[model samples]
Target: MIVGIDLGTTNSLVAVWRDEAPQLVPNVLGSVLTPSVVGLDDQGQVLVGQAARERLQTHPQLTAALFKRHMGSAQEIALGKRKFRPEELSALVLRSLKEDVERAFGEPVEEAVISVPAYFSDAQRKATRIAGELAGLKVEKLVNEPTAAALAYGVHQKDKETSFLVFDLGGGTFDVSILELFEGVMEVRASAGDNFLGGEDFDTALIQHFVSSQRQDKHFPDVNVPGMRNRLRCEAERVRHALGQQPTATFSLAQGGRQWELAISQDDLQHVSASLLERLRGPVERALRDARIRVADLNEVLLVGGTTRMPLIRKLATTLFGRFPAMHINPDEVVALGAAVQAALKQRAAALEEVVLTDVCPYTLGIETVEQFGRVLESGHYLPIIERNCVVPVSRVKTIQTLHDNQTHVLVKVFQGESRLVKDNIALGELSIPVPARPAGEVELDVRFTYDNNGILEAEVKVPASGEMHHLVIENNPGVLAPQEVRQRLAALAQLKVHPRDQMVNTTLVARLERLYQEHLGEVREMLGNMAGSFQQALASQDVECIAQMRESIAHRLDELERSPWQ
Candidate 1:
């Protein structure tokens, strides 16, 4: 089986290739969406998905959902005496996905091409690939989510010259990808996104709205209270959904010995959400700016995600681009569908010939030069030599003269970002090029950057005078692991004993939990069943609650089940 996983920050989903069709694997609950959350059981067992998410709502400090945002950071979250890197935690999610897909197909599936946001950094991208390895999956390819969505949407349109912008508002990340479809080839010109923004922002906006409503309308104290944050978030999401169509919607919460209700207007929501919307403007503008296509030139705008259902988003996108976005596939499924389509193509050679795609580096990639001047001489500058929207299978060369006299070695620090300062950009790696000892401006150096179909950046610094050249690859990044270290670690990882304690307990635990929730579905409904039924179903079926309904239901039951092991 070939699988496609959208390893999102807030949610993780698994899709499989079956008989030429990409089918989403429904969890035990018979649903597709899974919450990317995990918690620990009383017996030091790992819990994943919905149950894990529920633990976050009831036990906020213990469970984590948006760890994907912390991928490149030096942070750690400990659970049950085990310290986990973000990559490890993410690996567990992928492991669970692998397990569920195997159960659905009753076949072994090893290779997968997971999707990532277009704006992921080199460190982040490497970390993501590592997470895949830890989960025991061979990453066939890593495709950007927005570009995947473009493939799905582009195929439906017969217009040979259509250009579109894919506005993807996911659970924890937001991306805008501009693509042009020509002669069955979908080429991505520019992609931009905010890893920190998404449906969560709207939740924050709703929180602020409620905070004000409490202060003025109901005259309650500040909105902070035990369990109140979760209630506020839930109601905020509710109000956001309802206000999308209705002029107003009611939001009510019970906390601190009181029940508060709010009838929020759409205008109020748009106002409260203005700050969040303002943040999106930069990404949108940057994507279009890089694509070099005017909003007026775009034939259509493709909207992806449940959040795009918001009236403000459609309004803003239409206002900015002069065209209302099109939603051919379910916004929630467009990216996943695109992923499935790609996975299918990968399995069959015949399909590969029919499908051709071009994707670009979502952010600017540069190298730090001498001094604190942060000169990005290669592919990063005021005007990139290759240009953002240029056709791919392309190489661009930058010429730099020797800065100092008798400089034999030049240190080039490659970075990635749109920031104007060195401190603001991501330092990808460094390269040292040897030149014939010469005076200032005597030697000519050519820095060639070649980006291929996979979005992999290969750079070589050449000294024409001395005929010396040095090259750098993502894995060859200094101080990370010098190839030899990785081999040693993998050798070490083989003997590390990752607690493969047989599924005797895992199976029993899974079956018992499934049986309990299957019998009394309300345990999930009232607890997490508050969300859509299909979403909740996925939660109830996992060793971890991977959905809201599943999280709440499983966490509640687990709590009750924990109080009496003898029962």
Candidate 2:
């Protein structure tokens, strides 16, 4: 059965269309949300989800988190003795979710509709598809996260014609989309976002504040130590989550024979993360502007993603739109659920036969050209073919003549972004075609770019006189993996053994205890060690009830240790 997956930054989830509704699939931990983390255990088995996330605190050198931020780059996450590209790490998360869904459904999942941030570049989107391929799932479509959220909400509100703004702030990316639901069609009017702005930045800000505060007291923890930075990051995330529910949160850390404690209020968090909050405005304003609508024109503001759970973010969004945002669906699950809806739509499910969804290209697509201004000829100028926020499944063409006399060859360099200069934009690919030698400005080539609903681009350059044409499917670009490389990596990843699904809960518990053992000292360390030993013994006994009881006890004890003021 085909399912939908939200391959998120902080957490990932899967859902399927069942009994006329989308239902979330629970993982081995019996939770819908799985941490998007990957690591190597002492036995060199790949650990995913909570277990791997916990391992990040004790074995920083052997774990990777937040690799989503580097999806399309050359950056690699080094775990143990091996290095993995961002997509490889992402593939592990996808595989874990796929396994969960397979076990839950008692069937093999072959196809999926994966969601991505609306503003993700072409390279990032491609990486996501490759990741799915590596996980043995055919990615049928790459739905925009905000668009999926809108679809999930709009499907239930199909009776009304309404315009709404979707503000999606996730762990590693932010996206703003303006959508209008009229008749049976849900059309995304405009899309904008900051790929690097999200909840993680807020966590980083808090971590910095704690570090700086400790430095002032001369009890600074060496953040450069293997696991120290991750420890601080984990604590910072806890504080961020705590402040979401309460007025203040306290954080305590022990390192290098010194203990540090800090209390951060909600106000303090807002003040520290003010810049990130401000950054959110740019995308919102740009989306509204692009949609040719004012804030007052919007019927509602929809919030999506766990980051939007923060009161500070809610306040900022309310202040911007002068209205409270809607929280009808769980922000974390909305995208995945919407993806399921899209998957159903793809299959032409009877329940959604009348529902039609349309998306927009989040960035401009163009070609590099030379512009002549008086006596100066400026090369590397970007000429737009399809502007940003334009409706998808669109075909736009622009014609240009030869640059110089008897120019026998014309180069077509395709790019994406809204920039005046080509150098400032992302170059997709380039093709050089030979043309019959003609006088300057005599030979004109029709450059056409077609962007489909899935956000994939196809560029074609045709010369009518010579009946010559060059077409590019626009799959492999610089910085993105080629098809062969993706297949190679797929085979390599298939060989890496993932920790058995049945042992995930126990593994997660032990990883947490191990991390705590490394963080504490003296009595606390000894206590954690003993508890871990008992848990291991219980696991050896293979008594389901006793092992479960031990796990619960150990988890509660770890929670107590984490909350204790005395490190």
Candidate 3:
């Protein structure tokens, strides 16, 4: 079965279209929300999801989270003794989700439709595809998260006609998309976003506040300790989530032989996060301006993503459009459901037979050229062949003459972005085509760019005079992994030992206990350590009922301890 995956920065989920509707697949833990974290246990076994997330507070050196923010970069994170790329970390999460799908369907699955941010550049998109390949899944399509949300929303309103704006602010990215729906057709008019802005940044803001406050009192925590930042981050998230529901929450951390707490209110969060809020405005305004639709003309505004659960974000949306946005769909699961819809559409499912979809290229794509200013020529100018937000499966062409006399060949450097200069844009690839060496303007070249719904771009250069043509699909992009590198990564991934699926419950419990143990001191720390030992001894007994009973008993105690307010 072809599954739909929302490989998000903070969490990931898998869904499939079945029985004329989309259904989320539950993981082994019987939960649809799987934390996007990966780690190595003390025994060097691979751990993912909740287990990995728990270890972030105890075995921070052996775990990695939030790698999604560095998707297309060359940076490598150390997970224990091994170093892994962001794509590699992402693949681990995908592999875990793949196993979840197989367990749910009782069959082997190999193909998937994955969702990504709308404004992801070519490098980021390519990196996402490579992550799928590394996870042993054939990526059928990379659907933009906002577009996928619209597709899922459109599935419910296929018979109606309307225009809407999708505001998607997730764990680590923000996207705004303007769309129109009519007669079972969903068209994305424009897409824009900041890949670096989201809920994670809010956590960082809280962290900074706590740190700055501590500094004023001449008290400093040894943040250089491997797990200190993780502890602070956990508190920050707790405070952020608490503030979402209540007017105030305390950010508390135990460090430097004392308990540090700062009471933060909703207004304080908004004040400290002002810059991020401003960043959100730019993308929304740009998308509206690109779509040429006014706020008054939009029939509805839809909010998608877990970050939108914050009242601050909702308030911002309300103030922007002068209307309360719609949230009929579950923000967290909407993208995965939409991906399942896309998967069904790919198979031409009968329920979606009348549905048609069109998406835009989220960024401008073109070739670098020289602009003539009277007798002087200035290079580095960007000539757009396909402007941003143009509907895809689109092809656009531009013609240009050579700049110098006897130019033997014209080098076409392709780029993507809205900057006027190529220097400010992202270089995708370059192609050199031979000319007849005719004087300056005598040689004319035709450049064509074709963008598809899946966000792949193809560039073709044709020398009409010499009948010479060259085509490029941008495989040499610096951000993409080489074929050999992919093979080597595959080999390396194969060598890692994955923790047995049947023992996940015990693994997760142990990780949780370890984290709790690290958070307390004296009597509480001793109690947690003793509890962990008892659980480990129960597992060693090899008695199913004994282990099950002990697990329930210890889990209850942990829950009680967790529910208590921090010191």
Candidate 4:
């Protein structure tokens, strides 16, 4: 069966349509959420999810997390002895989710609908598709995360005609989408976001505060060390979560034979994270402006993503919209659940036969042109063929005159972005048309861009005079993969080996102990080392009861270490 996957920044999850509703598929750990982390064990076996995440604290140099922020870039993450592209790591995560769902359903699943940030560029969207393909799943669709969340919410509210705003703040990306539901149609009016903003930034803020405070007290660890920085990030995340549930929280760090304790208050969190809160307003305002709707016009504001649980964020959203945001669904799982609903719709499920989903191009599609303004030749000017927020599966044509006398050809350089300057926008592709030589303004050509629902752009230049057309299916742009490259990468990724599923629990425990062992010194270090040795002996025995007891002892020792201060 086809499923929906949320390949998130901090956590990934899978969901499928079952019994007329979307149901989450638990991982081997019996948890719906899997930490989006990838690493390698000491034995050089690939590790994913909780196991990899635990290694982050002690083996930071051998682990990769939060690669989603670099989705469209050429950046490579160095994990253990291997180097991998962001999409490659993402492919591993998708493969893990695929394996989980298959094991849970006792069947082989081959297709899926994956969710992405609504504001992701064409290159980013294409990268996501390539990742899915590499994971051995046929990606039928790439649904915008906020749009998917709206669908998950709208499916239950079919009887009501309403307009709502979806504010999505995930681990590493934030997207704001305006949607309208009426007469069995769910339409996305506008979407905007900052790919670099999200829950991680809040963690960074707290980390910085602690660092600055500790530096003043002269007791901070050297954060330049990857392990130390990751440890602080872990503590920061804990503090961020604790502050969400209470007025204050304390985080302790052991560094250089000293224990440092920091108390963070809710007010301190708001103060340190104020700038991030402000960044949220820009996208919200832009989405509303593009939709031509005021805050009062919105029937509701829906919150999505785990970050929205922060009281300060909720308060800010309420203040901006003049209404409390709706939390009718679990913010973290809603996007994946909606992705399942979309998958069902793709299959033409009987329950959603009347539901129609329409999405818009989040940015304007245009071409660069050189125009003569009363004797001045202006270059780098953007002439929009299709405006932002225009419903997709759409085509727009704009006729332009040649810029110079006797111009033999016209060049159409396609771009996508909201900027008025072509240089400021993302270049998609270009095409040159052979035009009949004529005086400026006498030679005309039609430049058309067709943006499909899959977020792919196709550009065509038509010379009506000679009935000659030049067409280009925009692909292989910078940061995007060529078809050949995608195939090659898929083949390479398919051959990479993951740790055996049945041994994951034992592997994870060992990795955690290895990390904790490195974090301690003196007696504690020796204690952990002995425990590891004993656990190894028990594992070699292959006795179920012995292994279980050793596992419990190791867990208790680790817990005690976490609570103990450095000597």
Candidate 5:
């Protein structure tokens, strides 16, 4: 079966179209939401989801989270003694979700439809597909998250004719999509967002507040330490969520027998997050302008992603549109459900025979060239072949002549973004096509860009005179892997020893104790060490009741010690 996966930054989920409707598939923990974290335990076994997240506090050096932000880059994150690319880390999460789907269906799942942020670049999209391959699944398609959400909403209201805005603010990325639905057809008019802006920025704001309040900047165990930062980030996440329902929440962190606490109000969160809120406005305005639809003309504004749960985000929407945005569907699950719907559509499911979906390229695709100004030839000009918001599965061509006589070859430098200058845009790839040398402005070559439904771009340069054609092949880009490298990486990932899911209860507690041991000193440190030893002995006995009792006793004691300061 082709399952749909939303490989998110903070959390991920899997869903399938069963019983003629989309249904979520729960993990071994019986929860559909899986924390997007990966780590290596003390046993040298890989840990994922909640288990890995717990280790982030206790074994920060061995755990990695938020790697999604580096998806299109060559940045390698260190987990203990080994380092891994973002795609590889994402592959581990996908593999875990793949297991969940198989367990739910009592069968193997080999193909999937994965969802990505609407504003993800071409290289990022390719990296996502490579991640799927590494996870032992065929990537059937890459659906834009907002487009998927709209498709899910459109399928339910098949006959409704309306134009709406999709405001998606997730853990690590933000996207604004404008769409129109009519007669069972959903069309994306425009898409815009900052790949770097998201809910995590709010967490950073909260972290800064606690840092300044506590004056921990000069502490012996500096707050900048990985373990300390993880502890603070975890507490900040809680306080941020709590402020959504209450006016005030306390941010607390414990280390070296001392507890630091700060009570913050919702107003404080808004004030600190003011700059981030402003970043949201530019994308919204740009999308609307590109779609040529006025805010008043929009039939509705649909909110998607878990970050939208914050009252502050919702309030911003209300102020911008003069009406509260619709949240009829669960923001976190909506995209996954939509992805499942897309998967079913790809299967040509009878229930979705009437539904037709379409999406647009989120950024402009062009090449760098020189423009003549009087007698001087100025370089670095960007000539767009395919403009942003153009419907996908699109092919656009532009013709240009040789810059100077005896120019035996034409170089095509491909780029993506809205910048008028090539220097300001993202370089995808480049190719040099040999041409018959001719006088200046005489040898014309045709450059064509074909953007497929999956958002992968292909560039071709053709010499009409000689009928010679060259295709752009991207190389040396750290984000993209060649066919041979992909095979090697796949084999490398297969050799990792993953910890069994059933052992997470024991493993998580041990990880927590290790974290506590490092945070304490004197008698407390020795006591925690002994307590961890006792729990290991209980596990070795293979007595269920004994292990349970020991686990409970240690857990309670740890909680008590964490809450109370010690001398």
Candidate 6:
């Protein structure tokens, strides 16, 4: 009765607990995917999923797909008269998914376990919870997408205690996770990802290719259109998707009303995306450095997301890791399945308590200070306050001598990133590690970093001699705007009738959700029948109130199902 949903930045998906396993549901289009799109029809009614996505090619002005990128930001996109905020738009996507699940079962769905990126901050995670609430289904658990994927792979066909890395490259975000599969338990040892990277970068690479190929093509062409840039961007995306396995893809684009056809080989597409592909190495390398391990030590490199289907990605991964990556679980649907299992466990629906998943904070959180060389202490130095891949139920304490003799209080600047320079990184927040005046190196500043089952970081600094203690989380956090702020700006942005953009989370969300829905139709249908018999009849009898009531009832059932479906 309960399903797991992966609300990705470029796409979305829904799956359910089944026969002691997780299965994805498919949409009505006979594909295990539905685009995460929404648009006003010609008649002013709203259309979502595949239909909304189709409108993108022609009705680019009205449709909005891939709004997930703006999740933690204060960006607001306008569609029509309604100035829907990101959370509201996200809720609409979840609502559409709810309807899809209902159609699959002819009953109402009430509960769900949703998956989000492991690196999502508290604000982003909270926003996701609210989106689930607005959709009328209870959120059983907010499982991290990477961790879920790990569980989906690690939980069954089980493994002994061993460490493996998960390379998750979706359409909008990329995450590298190291996990320890131990005695039926899946624990995240460390995680790092780039929110701005993924399949979208590949599209940009291809766009660069097209622009380069046209360097001197003077075949009656100025190559300009009011929306030429956007059109080329769309075409580039199409080509990237087509070149997944095919040796070649031929795409003709009409830019500025002038048509140009390019016969792109896989090699050509690969070359275009080479730079973007190159960018992934930094994060992957940084993560390994943080984990203090080489790729050769990994037991397996599991790939997650649709983009992993590409040949070059696989080749690059094999080249870097010196081993072939594992595949079988649908890259798009695995996260959703793992989410469902997590939901079931959270609700106590399954006897999986022995299964423990410990995830690490993706970003290094610390206070800023200057080095003797006039260097600044930055967040991404890879000198983790708590090193990545250190086993859980662990805490580390470090002490440093005060630099100044007369310092009464020390100012602390916290940051997140892999950069060495303070100016080149993100400031998480600021703090003052209090200390009494003393000669240089006379006072010891004690700092402790502790990590729980979840990877959230909390810092405690002690001026032991003065009995002064500073307890706080990481600082300099501008990564995610507050929810109220995102909402307020989103409402205002709605009035301008700004064009809906494809940020990409919606694209991945659609693909993932559709795949999940199709895999778990049988259980979903039976639950729908049991939850809304009268409503099903009303749907047939044209009774609005009964249908609405049944809808509410189905949602409640889903909520219950989400808490613990197997139980």
TM-score of each: 0.78, 0.96, 0.97, 0.94, 0.94, 0.72
lDDT of each: 0.69, 0.90, 0.91, 0.88, 0.90, 0.67
> Which lDDT tens digits does candidate 3 get at residues 1-567?
788999999999999999999999988888899999999999999999999999998889999999988887788999878999999999999999999988877999899999999988877888899999999999999999999999888898989999989999999999999999999889999999999998999999999987888886656677667788888888888888888889998887765567777889999999999999999999999999999999999999999999999999999999999999999999999999999999999888999999998999999999898888998889999999999999998999999998789989788899999999999998988887888987889989989999887798888988999998889756566577888999999999989999988999889999899888877877888999999999999989999999999999999999998777764
lDDT of 4 by residue, 1-567 (tens): 899999999999999999889999999877899999998877777889999998998788879999998887778889866788888899999999999999998999999999999888887888899888888989999999999999999999887999989999999999999999999899999998998999999999998888887787755567888888888888898788878888988876776777787888999999999899989989988999999999998999999999999999999998999889999999999999999999999999888988899999888889998867897998999999988899998999999988889989887788888888999998887777799988878878888888888887778888888789889666445577778978888887767677898888887888888877766677887898998899999999999998988898888868776654433
Q: Write the per-residue lDDT of candidate 5 for residues 197-262, one digit (tens) a residue.
A: 888889999999888887744553587788888987887887888888889888876666666678
The CA-based lDDT of model 2 is what?
A: 0.90
Q: List the residue pairs that clash in candidate 3.
A: none
lDDT at 238, model 1: 58
Best by lDDT: 3
> On residues 99-175, what C-alpha lDDT tens digit does candidate 1 reach at each position?
87887778887887788887776677767777787778888878888988887777555347789889998877889
When 1 and 2 are scored with TM-score, the better candidate is: 2
RMSD of 1: 7.6
User: Residues 366-481, candidate 6, lDDT per residue (tens digit)?
Assistant: 44554553464333232346544566545777776777677777765555554666677655556777777888778887777775544445667888889888886433444444
Any idea what lDDT model 4 has? 0.88
lDDT of 5 at 316: 98
Q: Candidate 5, TM-score vs. the true structure?
A: 0.94
lDDT of 2 by residue, 512-557 (tens): 8888887788998999899989999999999999999889888887
Once superposed on the true structure, which residue ranges of model 6 sit more than 4 Å away at CA? 28-31, 42-45, 81-87, 102-112, 119-130, 133-140, 159-163, 215-227, 255-258, 286-297, 351-354, 370-384, 389-412, 431-567
Candidate 3 accuracy as lDDT: 0.91
**Model 1 misplacement above 4 A:** 158-161, 212-235, 250-253, 259-262, 349-352, 370-387, 419-424, 434-436, 465-467, 473-567
